[model samples]
Structures are given as structure tokens and as C-alpha cells.
Target chain A: MTLATPPVGEPRHRRGSPRGTGAFDRSRRRLYLPFVVPALVLYLAFVIGPTLAALWISFHRWDGVSDMRWNGLDNYSALFDDPTFRTALANTLIILVVAGAAIFAISFVLTMIVREMRGRSFIRSVLFFPHIVSAIVLSIVWGFIFEHNGTVNTILSTVFGTEPIPWLNADNLFLMILIGTVWISTGLYVTIILAAVDRIPRYFYEEALLAGANAYQRLRFVTLPLSWDVISVAAIFWTISSLKIFEFIYAFGGTTNDMPPPAVWNSALFVYGESFGGRSPSYLFGYASASAILMLVLFTALIVVLRRLLRRDSIEF
Target chain B: MQMRYRRRRVRAAALTLTVTLGLFGAACSADDSGGGSAQQFTYWSMWQEKEPQAKVLAKALADFEKESGIKVKVEWQGRDNVTKLLAALRTDDVPDLIDQQYFTVSNAIVKNDQFKDLSDVHDMEIPGESKTVRQVIPEKYDQFTTTANGAQFLIPYEVIGYSIWYDAKTLPDVADNPPKTWQEFADVLARSKASGRNPIALDGDIAGYAEFWTATALSRTLGPGGFYKLVSDKQASGWNNPGVRNALAAIASLAKQKYFIPGYDSSKFPAIQTKWAQNQADFLYMGSWAPTETGTLAAPGFKYRSFNFPTFGSDESLPASVIGFAVPKSADHAEAAQKFIAHFLHKERLSKISSEANNLTPRSDVEVPEQLEDVNELLQEKKLSKITDGVLGDFSDFDKKVFQPLNLQLMTGKITPDEFIDQITTGQRDFWAGHRS
Candidate 1:
């Protein structure tokens, strides 16, 4: 019933105020009644309700189908012992740093490149092409490119004149996935930084240039600080996206069957495999859900840490 | 004229947006939901709904509608039916009749109570077959669909078997004919490699491949009860069981000798099937149902054929085996569902489906279509095996979780046959304890 509502507009505004429940005020309530209830209900039912349900469901031993049995703390206990889950958590961390650092560094460089270029629009479009491609599809291409006897091998064999390095072997499968994830996601951050940079006054950059500030000085003093708000937001998106990275890892490394060589399964894939009975004698929905909850905690902590560390001095350009 | 042109442009843009949104919405609406008329009963099926058997089903319903004035609507379950069906069941939107894979229905039945039993209505006639329904269905497959309380709700449907496939060009070069003994099989691989070809296009990571290495071969060679002594009874373990160790070692030996295509140690193993079909390999192991046209042997100017897995040694006797289907207790429309299922896999409908959709039939009485008769002839002549009997839960889940890691151990040469048994017994006991009903 609550999901029947939309998420905007207000008689919700008036109802919160106490003294407005009278005859003249009642007309405003009546005017806004139809619009407010639906939106409020929709938010309450879908967004708020499910988050709470998922939180509650994390404690139970249910495989999404069967009866949910109470197993308090057991799920959490199992997580520390799950090597694959530990591997997954480590991989998630590696991905977050690799993808986040790459996105931030690439976008910052590209932003400066575009600001100083005459063909800025064309350059921006070229840089932003990856954002237009779905991460899953890009992973497929990445898999083929990095697969044994695939594109990278062909190139390596021809140029380097060496034996074909196994791109998707146990040693490098996760790294290959990280490259694919970063490449597919970097362009969006560039777009975000560009939008923020466009808001800054052009005079500040001109003044910095006139004062004999070199390109690097102009960047450090002017563009970087002015674009802090957008950069922080984009970086936050990156951290969270990397932590929540499932589709590309799942699609490229394979969601089912095409697993990373043994002992190399990442946390999401590990939790997913154990939960889905891909493992023998598998029964750890509660453990998986707990690991997922642990992941959320890690994500929040990392975001807070990164935000504090990178919370830059905002320039009022 | 200018105003008219502007209006046309606006209309074209609106149409484009609408079409794009429509396509997206349609994609999201890919959940399988069967619809029925006032007099009609709806049926939902897994696998290819576009096949002629499905069309025949719709026609049967149409025939009933014409005579008895009842209509029928059918829907195809998606490849993602596990996710979709759970959502549908939660909504209590089960169709009047559903032709689900016995495994899908079974997985739901034990874990979730969503099926209806139809033992009383099991005698319903199929279009062509004369055998009683009981003879056609296997008990172990029936066991899969049974409840923990030992209730028989689901009926067996079609049984499919996996086999060894090769291009005819590679086969004669490896051996005079396909090898019957496991020793000869190893020799074939060696000869293939000697002839500068890898022997098999094996996808080591594929779950079915694990079973092909472990359960299918082990059970078929050892028999149902022998497999039980090994898996359930825990009597058969280690290098003592030649089939188990030999299969794993055989695969590892192949890997070591580079008898497999290059880079198989990684996940890129199956991606080399084009080369396998290109006659770069002498043998490839897969299901008998997979024909040359669409499978790994699918290549132009390539001739595809198959034989049963080779025997282990001079002492070993390998009999035939299979993977069969059964009805689940949780199926909502068991009586009507069984009738529809019977009609669907009935000899006439089975032939139609095999012809149109390239599926294998469980019933031998059904005439094979001219196109797929070669595949059928191979199954009959060589006595190609199945994995239906013995072991716990087809080792379907067991193979991936236990046997694979153990095989990797074999590949690394870390574990001997005795150690392999210790590994399986030690690890899989916990698994079997938790999983077995």
C-alpha cells in the first residue's frame, strides 16, 4: 500500500506543523493530500522497508527460498574462517584502491588536459566513451582481449617476441578484472570533474597564468581546489562502486562455471558461490549475508577514511 | 511547409524515445508467466519454448479447445528460472500446468514446498509411446523430486546422457577405432599429441566436466551400488578405486603432456573449441545430446562423431549409465502437469522437440528424426553411459565442491590415490552429512 506513492511534492510539508490542523489549513492539506501520500508511501515501502528487511534477514539462515532458521552470531563466526570470503574481501579492497586511484588520477589529468586544449569538447567525448559502454559488455571484450591466445597474447607474441603470458591464469585473473573495471568506470568521473570545473570563473585561471604560474602550478593552485566538491563526490562514487563491484567481476571472471583458478576467488564471488551451493555441502546463506554486512561496514569505514584524508581545501573560484 | 517539417521532426524524436523505453521495459518483463482463457489451462515450461514440441502442445490445447471449447496458454521459463520462479512462487502466481526440469522442480521441492503430486494421474497416454509411465522414469531421479518425508510427487520426464565427441579425421589417426579400454584411451591421447594435436577440448572449470571426470565415469564403470559404497557408504576411497584416481590422473597426465590444448590450466580452456573443431584435437568429452552443428565440433568442413568413455583397464567392465528426470512434490498442478509433461515427452512430441530444438530423448521407443538419428545411433550402438544412479544427489553439487579441488590436487601431484580417498572422505563427509536428505 505504501509503494503506491511517488517520491515528490508536498502536503507532507504542512502536516508536520502542529497548529495548521484547522479549517483554513485543512484546505491546503486537502489540496496537497493526493500528491504527498503516494510519494511518502513509495519511499517508505521500497527504499526504507527493504533496507530494514535486508538488515534483519542478515541474521537468519535462509537460502532465499527455504524456511529461515534463527542462528544468531553463527553467520558472523563463520566469516572469519572462510578463506574464500577473506580472499573476496581482500580483492574488494584491491579493486577499490586500484579502480579509485586510477579513476581519480585519470580524470584529474584529463580535466587538466581538456581545460588547456583547444579541442576540449572532442577530447572530452573521447575520454568519456567508456562511460557509455556497460561494464558487463566491456568485461566480455576484456576477457577475450586478455584470454590465453587472445588479443593481448597475439600482440605480445608479435611485439615482444616472447611466450604468451597467461592473462587469466590464477596469477593475473583478478588483475585483469581490475583493469576492466577501472577502464569501464573511469570516464564517468571525468564527466563529473568537467561539470564541476566548468562552474569556476575563467578569470582565476587567466590570473594564475599571468602571474607566471606553470601548468602544474596553475593546476595545483587553481583547477584542483575549485573542482574539490565534484572530485570528492566522484571519488566517493568510485570507492562505493568498487566495494559494490559484482557485475564486472561476475561477468568477466564469470558469474558461474568460469571461476578464477583455485584459491583466487574474490569476496563477492566467494560469498555468492558458497551461498548458491556451487561449493559442495554448501550452506552459508547466513554466513554470506553476514559477510555482506561486514562488507557494508568496511565500505562505510573506507568512505569515511578516504573522505577525511582527501577532504581538500575548497577554493572559492 | 517549415512548420510541418518541424512537427515531423518532433514526432520522430518522440517515437524514438517511446520505442527505446518500450524495448527496455520488455527486456525487464522477461519473467515467464503463462496466461489462460476462461476455458483454457495454462502451461509453463523450461528450455526452448520455440521448439515444435511446444508448438505441438499449443496445438493439443487448441485441439482440445476446438472439440471441448477450452483454450490453453503456455509460457517458457527463462534460463534464469531459479531466480524468476522463486519470485513468482512468493507472489503465489503458479501456472495451471508447468513443465519444469526435474532438477529445477526437485531443488525447489526439498528446499521449498511448491509442487503437487500426480501419482494417480500418471497413467495418461502420450502421443506415440506405449510403455507405462513408471518404466520410463528412474527411481533415483524420482528420489530427487521426493520430499524429505519420502513423498513421491514428481514424475520422471526425459533422460539425457553425456558422451565423448571427436572429428572423424582426428579419430582414425589416434586409434584404428574409438578406444574401449581406458589404457587405449590414454594411448589415443598420446598418439594425438604425438601427431601434433591435443586430444581433448576440456573445460576444466565447467561443473559438468568434474562429474564427467568423477561420478559419470566412476558410477557407470563401477555400477550404482558400487558408487554408493564409495560416496554414501564411504567404503570406496583413495587410489584403491582405480576409476576415480585414474580419471583424475588421466586428465592431469593429459595436461602435463600438453595433450590438452594450450593454456587449459587457466579458465580459457573451452574457448579453444574452434580449434578442436578445426582438427587441432583428437577428442572432446561432452553430452551425447550436443550435436556437431552447435557444439564444440561445430565447424565448417568438420565431420563430428562420438563414442562412450573408454574403459579403465583389462580388469574393468564399464556398463551404460544416464541422467534422468522426475516430477517434484511441490509442483502446483501435478495431475494436469503430469498429463502435459507426458504429452510433451511422448514419443511424437519428443521426436518433434529433438528435431526442432536438438534435445535428447529418454525413451528409446521414440523414433529419432533423420537429422539426429546419427546421434541416436551412436547412443544405442556404443551403449553411451549415464550418471542417474548411485552417489549422493548426482554428485551434481558434490563434483564442483569436492572432486574439483581434489582433481587439482591430483594435477599438482600432491595427493596419491590413498590420499585422494582420505581427501574425499574427510571433506565430503561434512558435505554429505549436511546435504543428504
Candidate 2:
């Protein structure tokens, strides 16, 4: 496998090769196996290896300590009936669709506004700052902003003479989490969409304006179509990242140092809660693995569907 | 010819380097796997290195090594101690001694049969003391310390329990003569409200804390082990018990009357608990760790005091949780680990748990810390039960999915007692139906 590796590793070395010469192309091809083989080996060992192992584990009843007992399909059946897992799966989908929609909608608007605004780069940087901050820090700050006597309620009570709202109560907690997630996530997507928007030559907007294009027309025809590829990639990125969001919601149990209520759990939190998290670690490795594998299959299919829907022909400027 | 030869040599070198690096990476990933010598058993504690409990235990570990002339290797793994140990269980590198809350050990290690039965340790005489290990820790603690089949998998060290914690300076009337029944408890809340103070300070965001109201009330109504039985029934028939409805109604009344601090349902955990410590509210149903957790933020003159969960009907079962040491069955230095357990159980050594860590120890002879005096007296009473009657450990996923959410709804007045019963009944039924193999 190593012997036939490609010269994809050293483009500079291959750049000097004559374009149509068989000898140079053959030599470059000779390096292919060695370069690609190592990465393929590492990927197999790290990523594909554990994933297969998890698939195998999903069929058994293992506490992660004792010998694994084969219990074919029981864990999967149990997951379907497990209300917490259902809630988690539903929460994951809600974040993917609802929060995803809000983030893109707001980010596109922000991109359009900032594209024409003064100091656009500075505004973009200011907006992108939250993405760079740790989710733990962001969630804590969010908790402080929404707690009953928190910043929002304090202002409401003091200025508006209103009762302090229970923004973090069970009825409203997941909503607050979704809004915070959108607030933190919008900045990164906006920056991506904006960077793509900026790459479009300014003449496109000018030409559209001369043709009597309204703001929406300029956005639909000139901005979005030009940035469609980045938006598609960003959508996929958000889908995966949203599923992996455990730390932010987990930190809501702050200072008390327990997991947040199961009512608010997403798929990642469900996996952790069943396996290694919580005061009494369930260590239901087999069951947790089953849930994890189910989520992986569901999301993989969703991504495929998304790619198919978002596929667009590239426009040459 | 020269160019081809050089290229071949370069390829060979690259291949060699890749194989060498791969082998090196594989070697680095392997844990340092071995059980240490008998003279130097390893220890992993559930306390962080800087925690007061770790400090006290560190001193004891150091002293034990000096006296026994056996080196002690200790790691302060904090709350993840058991987790790390579980990951290391199949490896030869498993720690010789580890400690965590009893049920945590019970649910994780004991159930797996990875733990060594410590029944012999009960008979081992304490270092420089006449009493055996069994004599030092009271028999009453066996409710928490012993497993269902009577296997003592862990040796007792610290005792943790839950109660209605309050500031003595703020409610000296209740502190002087604490309420014993549910009606008296209601009167106390009403009187506190009449005096213009929020009667209960709860961090409702912590569903576990919120569920304490139902857990204790159910325990009082259904008698010892009643709550666990109710939640764990295979048929889910126990949820229909009149006692369960009564327990729900009692807490529902508190929610309807608005006894909790304003917006308690939305306050982040430890925030409302901190306010309770600051004497902003009158009472908090919490664990014995309340004082230590809130100590730095407490009001200047805040006096920590507690009373048992006000009884419903005639039962007076008190909830107790234990934290102590256990040895793995695979431990190479099992004898040495057992020796350390006996050494730590000595009154002189265990008293430091109270004095330095400000925690309650299982040793009846050890002088209880002032902060834990109320809790200690409560544990000493005749009737005792395990935390949440051990439901939270045995059926933890059920607790997380079924019990906590519904109980929270009941506590927040989002649902009535009847709805709580109805929802929990279906939830438990579905849980067992799916779980039955």
C-alpha cells in the first residue's frame, strides 16, 4: 500500500514536472501510494476502527466492566421505548431544523446589512468573537443573563416595573438554550457567508441596482446564489456541530455539578448520561452505544439528503 | 540510473520513518500497565488534590506509609476517580484502593463484580485500637454500606445525608423546636410567609434537588424502602398507591402557596442555594454538603442547622449516603489496600474527616464537626434509609427519565398530583416494558 502512494503530499516537487511528459507523471504517480497509504491507515485505525467496535458493542449488554452479554437488538428496541432517548432525538432534530433555520435566516440578514455598512470587517470580527470563546464560558454567561434575578429579569423588574420572569424554568429552559445557541452560532455562519459574499465582485450588486433590483432581489439573485456553496457546507457543518453540543447544556447544572434535566437533553447528552456522566454513572455502554449508532445513521442519511437538495451548478463570474 | 536509485532510497527512508513513527505512537498509547509491589499499593481518591477531604486523606496516607514502611502511590482523580478506574479495570494498572460514594461504587463496580468483598476488613482490628473495624462503624450504617446480598464491598469513612437545612440565626424558633410532621412543616412555612420571608429556597433547575421534596415525602408515607419499591416495580403498580398521591399533593400545596423564593424555578443551581445561605430565604432541602458548598458565600452570621424531612403520617425514615474505600478484585496489593482501609477507619485517623474536611464520618466515636452536628444526630436515630431509598442508583436512567421530570412538574405546579401519578405510571410501565428482556 505504501509503495504506490501519490505525490499529493508534495505539490511543489510535482510542479516542476513537464505537463505532458510520461516520465514525470509516472514518477509523480509512484509517490502516490506511500503518501496516501499512511493517512488511510491512520483514518482506519482511529475513526473506522472504533465505529465498527461500537456497532459490535451495540448488540450486547455490557456495563463497560463485566463481560459483554449478547442481547441482539434489545438495546435498539429499548431506545425506541426510552422516553429520554426520544426526547433527546426530538431535541436534536428541533435544534437541527428550528435553530438551524433561525441561525441561517438571521445570519443572512446580518450579512446583507453588514455588507453595505461602514466598518464591515470590524463588525464581522466583533460578531465572530463569541464563536472563539469556549462553550462552557458562553453557557455560564447565558445562564447569568437569563436566570430569574439575572440581567434580563433585573432590567425588566427595575425599569418596566414587571415581575422577574422565570426564563430558565423547565417550561422555558430549552427555548432559552435554543436562542443562546442561535446567538452564539449565528456569528460564525455570518462570517462564512459574508466572506463568500465579499468574494463576489462589486459589479454584481451595481449591475443589479441599475436593473432596478430591490434589496430582496439583490439578496436572492446576487448574494445568495454567489454564496450558495458556502451556505450548503455551513448547513452540513451546523448539523454535525449541533448534535455534538453537550457542554453548553450540561453546564446549566453549574455549581451544583450535575447534569441538566433529561427534559432538555440532546443526543450527545443522552449518550454521556447513559455511559459516563451523572452522579451515578449508568455505564450502560451497550445501550448508550446503540443510541449513538442510531443517531449516527440518522444524521448520515440527513446529510446525504441535504447534499442532494443543496447541489447547485457553479456560476463563473 | 542515478536518479532512479536516489528516488528508491528516498522512498525506502520515508517508508521506514512512517513505520517507525507508527510503532512509536502505538507504544505511547499503551497505559503503564502493572500492579505495584505489595509494599507500595496505589490509591485513587474521589477528592481533588486541593479539596479539604483530599488534604485530610493525604495526611493520613502519608502517615500510613511512614508507620507501615510501605510506600503509598496516590492519585487525586476527583469525581472521575471511579470512571478512570473502570477504564483501567481490564488493564493490570487498576488502582489498589479507591473511594467514592457507596451507591456510585455499588452501581458501577460492585454490580460488575470488579470489586473485592471487604467482609474480612470488618473483622480486621483497627491500628492502635481495641475495636475491630465492625465495632467502630455503627451497624445502622449497614443500610447504606452493605449491598443487597449482604456483601460489604466498601469500608465506611464518610456519611452524607439530606435534610431541611436552615440558618439558625434566621429561624431560631424552628431551630429550637424543629417540626416533626407534615402539618407542622406547613404551619412553619405559613408563619415564615406571614413574617414576609420566602419560606423555601430551591434551585429548581436542579431536578434532583426538586425531587427531594417527593422522595422524602414518599419515604415518610410509604415507610422504609417504599419509594424505591414504588419506582422500581416491574408492573408499575406502585405508582397508584394512595401514599404516592399524598406525597405529590403535599409538595403541590407548597408550590401553589408560593412558598419558594420568587422565581425559584428559574434560578440556576447553587444560586438559590447560595441565597439560602445568605439568609435571603428561610429553608433549603439539601444534602449535608450545603454548608461547605455555600460557606464562602454565606451571610456573615449564618448559622448552619438542619432537621429531618418533616414526616408524613407516622414513618420517620432518615436518608443516609456513605463514601468510603474499596479494593478491586484484580488488585495485586489487596492485603495492603485492606490494611489502609483498616488504618483509615481508626478513630484518630477518621476524626480528621470531621475536623479538617467538615464532613460526617461513619465512625460513631469520632467527634462530629459543628457544621454536621444536626445531620450526625439525625443519622444516629433508629430508623434510617439510603438516599432516594437507592432508586437513583439502581434505576438511575428511570430516575433521570421518569421520576425527576414528572416530580419537577409537580413541584413547579405545572401539573397536579393526579397528573404526576398518571404520567409517572405510564412512564414507568413503558420503561419496564422496554427493559424486560
Candidate 3:
């Protein structure tokens, strides 16, 4: 029952070590800084530089074209009072938590069922297909399914004798979007969990069965623990990706070329709507930036907490 | 080994710093070279290249190039030209001419002072016509040309009037005898429903479409100035105006009676418009562009005609908007851009825009396409009014907070008439309070 554990806190390279004397290790060390510095420079210029600029912009009043005026904390204070920003913030959290939980739970169940099936590869591929399709296309198709007099309504009326539902109305739109996000995201998580599950040694499951453990017990003791690290990583991925969901929701506005109703807007949509969206772009760059920076700070804190909650001692194999 | 590793790290850091500095240097020096003998200008158009307006503009540009010996580079940036034009204004590279809807220019770009004053163009004679630019374009279209600061910033190129459209084939009798009063309109809807036809097809997915009904109703009930008081004046009592409640209630009753096509609330955009074109509904309230925008989706031989939105007692103005073009302040070839504008507005050229493009040209002398003959009649009769003119320049916030949300709720039957008024009044008060500080 012994699990192989790699040294957690040990440095890869120690001065005068026997391993460091190897030619490959020495050459790899020599090339490491050269290879990493290029990408690091780009990352700083494009990602970090703009982020810092946004932070600076958040403290000023700007319309993208006008000379920026220092507004101190006024923009930040205004965001708290903005009803649209509050709705966007609430929507972002719901997608991150509710949609994330649904995606992982569904993926895990599907992965468990498909692992031992005869056509497991086909089923896995079929489930994984949505991950590759552009989210805008998926959103359009999803809208059609739930649209009044759409596929869902037609089926309900002819087969079940039920009335059509207002699936895309203001009160119900965000809920429908949450469900659509879960449906689109589950496949990718299932594929990742399945890969992790496949890596677990077959002998561990066999031993669990030999000890008279039931199917659920085997999954609980062996499979779950073995895939814990991957699951935690997936959780972090979902958090970051969920905060950036824009195109799918933006498409929901249809041919109108206007921003979606504030009730359904997430933080990303809020940034655009405030700054450069709407039929006539608002150009409230400072206000938009304040909300954006606030969301980033909140998201960063959530990610750190998630990592701590999901942390566990890793088994090498 | 430690010394060698430190030396390698230092070398890598130096190399990376040098490369980064070199990249910045290259970016700084990348400027357009400037010695062309030929007269050249760059134009960014808001219309897609294949759209009828763009096609006619392209023909006009070609004619201008041939006659004037100007090499014009045209970029079809489509609906995003306003944002692109704004960005371009901040940089050295800019388009000599940009086309945008009049509302966008007045409310977004011109408000920000991005466009050059084109008042001189108003006095310039058309290239091949006897009239000056201002003489050919009717005075009603002047609302779109003038900015908040009283400067003429853009030229109105197309005339767009908002009204109720009906397919002659679907409701032949109604098309011939359009509703002219609130009660008549209501009775028409009821009769249409009783005859097994959906009275209206609304693209409710976009809240703007739903807001149109409220805007028209309010303008009719309150008169244009009173409607402006309700939306733009930011006075809380504007919402308390009995006319405001009645207008909202009128629209709400349509939803209450299910006069709109079933499932309109959940229908995808253009889907409801397509349904209207297919004659699934007997009527659609839309802009003058409705015929052209939905023409392809129309049932075969579906002839479309539009009439002014029927008035409530004492209200008679038809809601109108305009689409047009402008030159940016940063333009390098402003003179050439003006020349191009004058050429495009020539009587023959405008006639082509009307005939070939199936659009309502702003020039009063140009004969409109047969499809828009009804709309032209309204214009000729001087029955048009700016539907949302009251809030046009400074109502973006109120639009988002009050108009858009409550309109959707009212149309979807989520709120009563009283609740709608209460929410809007409270919302407007809070919005103004926040801005006042």
C-alpha cells in the first residue's frame, strides 16, 4: 500500500551536486535563462504592462481619447454604487461556483461510467466534441434549443402537451446561460479526469476489489485520491476561464449589435458595456477599468483560497 | 561550476535586455513614408462592402477617382467604424472620411469632439448639380447634422423613419387603410387576433426593439416635447405625467392581450423579423430599413408597406432617424474628403443610391425606390418627428437603467403599468442624484 512520494520542497539544482555535474543538466541550465527570458519579456509587455496600466487608469477619469484626469478613488467608489456592476459581479461568481460545481460533478460521473464501457473511446470522443467547437457557435445552437417555439418547446408541445417556456426572458436568461456554460464545459473536464484516472495503476483497484470493497468504496479510496491533484488543477482552470467568459454571452444579443441586458451581464461584459460597447459606445474607460481591476483582485484572492483548499500531499505514481 | 552558471545567467540577461530594447526601437521608427505625387486619400466606411449603400458609394468613389484623378483607398470597417475612428484620431494614421449613423456621430463621436466641423461642405455646390449640399438635403435632416455645441459635424446621407410595417399580401385591407389613432390601432390588433393572425411580430431579444413601442407610444401621447421632458429633463414628475402612464399602459395592454406573436419574447433576433416577413404575423413595427433588411427572408411576392405609428389624441409626429457620413479632425486630406462627399451627393449619384441601392436618400429631389414610396410620402407631408430625440445626446445612462429594463419587463408581461412607472421614476431620480454630485 506504499505510495511513492517525491521530495516536495527540494531544489532541482544544488551547487556541486553529483546530478548537476552531468553534461545534459549543465547544458540545460545554461539554456534555461535564454529560453525563458524571451517569453518573460513578452508576458511582461503585453499582460503585466496592460494590467498595471489598468490599475493606474482605474484611479483616473478617461474616455480613451480625452486627456486622463486624476479622480483618485472616485471611480472605485462609483463602481460600488453602480447597479450594473453589482449585477455583473454577482453573475460572475454564480458562473464560477455553480457552473464549476456542476461541470466537475457531471464530468466525474460520466468519466466513471465510461471508463469500463466497451465503446469507451467513442463515447469519450463524443462527449469531448463540444470543447473544440467555438463557444459563439455553441451559444447560438444553445439559444435555438431553448428559444420559444424552438426545438425544446416544439418537443414539449407535440410530445408532452406542455406550453412553451420563456427560457430567454430577463428573469430566466442568466440561469439558462449558467446551464449552457456547464453543458459546454463538462466535456473538457471529463476528458481531463479520465486521463488522470487512466494513469492510476490497475493493481490498486484490483487489490481494493480483493479486499471485498464495493464499487463505490473502490472509487472513494483509490480513484478519488489518485485523481485529486488533477481535479484541483481543473478547479483553478475553471475559475480563471469562467471569469473571462464574454463571447458566448455577447452573442446572446443576437442581430441587434447591442449589449445584453444588465441582468445577464458578467464582469467581462460589464467592462465592454461601460467602455466601448452599446449601440453608441459609452467610452467610460476609467469606470470600466475600476470594475475590471476590482474583479481581478477578487479573482486572485479566490484562486489562492481554492489552491489552499484543494492542496494535498502528491503521490509520484 | 557555480562561477560558470552565474556567467551564463548574466550573458542571457544582457542578451534579453538588448533584444527588448531593439524591439522597442523598431516599433518607434515604424512610420509611414511620405512622398507620393498622386493625390491619395483613405476612407473608412461603416457599411459592409456588399451592402447596397456601400455598393453605390463604391460606384460614386470610382466615378470621383476617374474624374478628379484621385487615388482613394477605401476600407469597409462596417458598424465598428465609430470605435475605429476614435482610436484613429488618437494616432497619426487616420482616415480622411468615415461613415456612421447620425445618432452615433451626434451622441458618441461628435459629443467627444472627434469629428471635424463640416459646415463648409454645406455651402459647397454639388459636383454636377445646380444645388448646394444644404439645398438638396431637406431641413428635417438637419437635426442629425448639428452637434450639441451647435456645430454642423456630419452630412446626412440616408433618411430612416421608424413606423409600423405590414405586408400588403398578408393584410391587404389594413395596408390600404392603416390605423391613425390609438383606439383604431387596438381594434385592428384585436380583429387580426380574432381572424387567427398574430397582430404583431416583435424581436424582443434586443430590448431596443421592445423600447421602440414605448418610445412611439410616449411620443404620440405626450407630444415630442413632453416625451423629451419625461426622458431628458430628469425630473421625477415626468414619469408621473398621466400621459406617460397611459402610453406605457397602452403598450402593456398589447402584451396583456397577447397581441404579439406567441413566443416573441424568446425568439432570436431577425427570427421574429423573418416571421413577420413570412406573414406569420400581420404587422411589424420597425424602421424604414425594414424592407431592405428583411427583404431576402420575405415570402415570395410579399409586398411591404409602412405607415406612421398611429397617434393618441392630439399627437401626430412620425418618429424619424438618419444615417450619414463625416470627416475626422485628424484627416490628412479633408479637401479631398469634401470633394468625395459632394460627388456622392450629386443629383444623379443620389438617384442611383435611391434606385440601385433601394434606400431613402436624404436629397429631397432624388426619387425614392418604390418600396419606400410610403415612407417618402410621410416625409413629403412633413409628418416626421425625432422619436428618441429628447434623450438622444445624454440619455445613455437613463436608457440602460430605466428605458431598456422596464420596456422588456412591460413587453414580457413581467410588470404592471403602475410598477413600470414607479420603477422608471425611482430609477431616473437615483440616476440624476448620482450624476448631480
Specify the highest-lDDT model's number. 2
CAPRI-style class, candidate 1 = incorrect
Q: Write model 2 residue lDDT over B1-437, tens digit each, in one string.
A: 89888877877876887797799878877767445457879899899999999998899889999999878888888898888899989776888999988888888888778889899999999999998998887888777767779988888799887889999988889988999999999999999999999999998877778877888788788887888888878788887777777778889999899998987888877789888888889999888888889999999988899999988888876787889898988988989989989998888889988888888888777898787888888888747787787888888878877888888888888999988888888888888888732
Q: Order the numbered candidates by DockQ, best leading.
A: 2, 3, 1
Q: Evaluate model 3: give its lDDT.
A: 0.82
Question: Residue A298, candidate 1: how far off, in angstroms?
Answer: 2.7
TM-score of each: 0.78, 0.94, 0.93
- The candidate with the higher DockQ, 1 or 3, is 3
lDDT of 3 by residue, A102-178 (tens): 99889878987988789888998899888889989988898888888789989989999999988887778888888
Q: What is the DockQ of each candidate?
A: 0.17, 0.51, 0.40
Q: Candidate 3, which segments miss by more than 4 Å at Cα? A: A5-30, B1-29, B33-38, B390-393, B435-437
- Residues B325-428, candidate 1, lDDT per residue (tens digit)? 23334444444445556655555555554555555565666665543454566545543333433232345345545566676555434565567677777656
lDDT of each: 0.59, 0.86, 0.82
Please tell me which predicted candidate would have the highest DockQ against the true structure: 2
RMSD, model 3, all Cα superposed? 3.3
**How far in Å is the alpha carbon of A51 misplaced in model 3?**
0.8
Q: Itemize residue pairs with steric clashes in candidate 2.
A: A4-A33, A5-A31, A5-A32, A5-A33, A5-A34, A6-A31, A6-A32, A6-A33
**Which DockQ-derived CAPRI band holds candidate 2?**
medium
- For every candidate, how close is chain A to the native chain A in TM-score? 0.81, 0.91, 0.92
